[model samples]
Target: MVLQVSDSDPAKWNLALNNARNIQQDLGKGNVAVEIVAYGPGLGMLKRDSKVADRLAQALDNNVDAGVVHIMKRQREAWAYVRP
Candidate 1:
């Protein structure tokens, strides 16, 4: 599953990571793949000094794919358009 984060808030990052963990628990590890794409101000969540850096590291350790889009404006608009 693909999880998109557009905010840099720690709470949002925590919630998204928690949800990913819950899904892994429900479906069994290695059975599912989670891709966390962070753009705009949300890219801060992946930084080393981010408040949720540990959580992001944990997710990475669990084989979750995390990435950041360099073009913020375009990525944000694309995400907005894709969301229901």
Candidate 2:
């Protein structure tokens, strides 16, 4: 499934994250691949003080070595500013 997030609203970020989580849960872990590519203003939502940090942190903690991957490498410069 392809999901796109384009705003910096915390609510929108949570929805996108929840949707992705739901899909991953529904399909069963490791049975499906889910990736999030944050770009434009949406990338700011992944910044140091965004509201989504805790959820993102939990996800990173759980999946770091699980072979599940995400984040956009399209614009390397912009990507350089975001940390898991």
* TM-score leader: 1
Clash number by candidate, in order? 0, 0
Can you write out model 2's per-residue Cα lDDT over 35-75, one digit (the tens) per residue?
Answer: 55555687677677888988877765332221113433323
Worst 10 residues of 2 by lDDT: 61-70
Report the C-alpha lDDT of model 1 over 10-70, residue by residue, as the tens digit. 8888878887788789998788765566767887678899999887887774322334442
RMSD of 2: 8.3
- lDDT value, candidate 1, whole model: 0.67
Candidate 1's TM-score reads 0.69
Superposed Cα deviation of residue 4, candidate 1 (Å): 0.5
TM-score for all models, in order of appearance:
0.69, 0.65
RMSD (CA, angstroms), candidate 1: 6.1
